[model samples]
Target: MKEGIHPNYREVCFVDLSNGFKFVTRSCANTKEMIEMEDGRKLPLFKLDTSSESHPFYTGTQKSVDTMGGRVEKFRNRFARSVK
Candidate 1:
């Protein structure tokens, strides 16, 4: 709220690498590169490694972990046989 003490909040564009999706929003984060939007507006292009669009929680494309495999599963099976 002070003079020149607040960060500049401006409209920026975020691009998801995996999905190649683009979205416009306001942000105070800095970026080294930018791109022009369809509205003839210069938007700071921010490259994010992950976003909700491509994330497993939002997209519902999650992979399950198989614990019953490999050396651990074999050891467990052997141990159970020994116990019995």
Candidate 2:
């Protein structure tokens, strides 16, 4: 371990911008924002676009693509003309 060559790792708040979900965890990232917590304390705030709360895979809202049906239809259409 070297001294004065490592980033400052501290507790920071990550806020999900999509659903307004907030959680605190340790991170070494840099931020220029601050947020007040519920207990009248201020912490470094970081905004995120998506997290486990609103992700499609984690929330079970992912849509299955119908590629097999599309491929079968295309194959039938293409070979049907040649066969006829």
lDDT (Cα, tens digit) per residue for candidate 1, span 1-84? 579988889999999999889999999989989898888998889998889998997888887677578888788888996775
lDDT of 2 by residue, 1-30 (tens): 989999889999999999999999999879
Q: What residue runs in model 2 are displaced by over 4 Å at the alpha carbon?
A: 67-84
* For model 1, the run of ten residues with the poorest summed lDDT: 63-72
Report the alpha-carbon TM-score of model 2 versus the true structure: 0.78
Backbone clash count, each prediction separately:
0, 0
Q: What are the lDDT figures for the candidates, one per model?
A: 0.88, 0.94
**TM-score for each predicted model, relative to the true structure:** 0.71, 0.78
Scored by lDDT, model 2 comes in at: 0.94
